[model samples]
Target: MGYINIDFTAGCTNNKWENLLHTHSIIQLVNTPTRITSTSSTIIDHVYTNHPENIVETVVPKIAFSDRYAKCITRKINQKDMPCLCHKQIRYRCFKNFDENNFLGDLNKTSFTQIEQIIDVQSATAMWYQLFLSVINNHAPIKMKRIKHVRQPDWLTDEVKEAQKKEKCLPKQRELE
Candidate 1:
């Protein structure tokens, strides 16, 4: 579990954020004093890492295109444990096809004599839960669903593609201008 701290807002004087630096063993990476705001001269933007020894160094690029200074961190990790982990996706029924009449019939078949004879509160609760699950399993059994990915439509015209391209590029174009 690797932890990274990226603070973009003005957090230098904020007591809540400053407390984290003291409580946790995180090391600050951005060192240059000029990385702070020019007008306020406050070190707001920061990047911290728990594994400071693993990191080679941090660099603040020249603010040529944007006001915020982006910090770049380089870390060396053990390659033996670098393989990505994949977990099997689990899918369960959302109970959209639950039959009320079938569920009522199954619940009616449950023996009530055992529950009536229960003296302890915990035992009664457990018996009720077990009976409920048994009824539900018989009437509305859960089904595993398989995921299906839908491909994009190939009927899109050249004009629509051009419009979509323009829409994506509009933000960057506005920022540059």
Candidate 2:
């Protein structure tokens, strides 16, 4: 496997991670490793600014695996009018806050004070639900069963070949004319 080292020190001051920009005909893989590491400077900025390391670790992984998770999230949120943040780093920030609030699971009774100190329950519930929707958007399950075999290759197995002899034997439509 090849790894690319992203050095923040090499970035221009006032950098907005513009050097990592990619022109994509399909935005499905926006969070892939190449795309994510392009923002190494921003991640380093957060680490130096005293943000929690857990947040950084969690977010960076998501950004790096853009082909897997990024594509999933883009489709889940639909190709409609949802804000861009709902599919990008902004989603990570939202998840961090939601996790801190224990949105996926409840905290132990002893940690009630800790929960109160970090986040309020009122926003916690709504934020938690929003994050849940984000996950659903990004990780939509592939429904392979729903997909019919629309085309078959000539080189496929015997059963497939038996199914469509005409595909190979039929006259070429362009030549026929």
TM-score against truth, every candidate: 0.37, 0.14
Cα RMSD (Å) between model 1 and the true structure? 22.4
Return the lDDT, model 1, position 175. Answer: 57
Per-residue alpha-carbon lDDT of model 1 for 47-131, expressed as tens digits?
6778788888777676635555566778888878775354334334356778888778778888867888888775665568667
* Cα error of candidate 2 at position 123, Å: 69
| Cα displacement (Å) at residue 113, model 2 | 94
Question: Runs in model 2 with CA error above 4 Å?
Answer: 1-3, 8-58, 61-147, 152-177
Clashing pairs in 2: 31-66, 32-66, 33-64, 72-138, 73-138, 76-137
Q: Can you give the lDDT of residue 17 in candidate 1?
A: 60
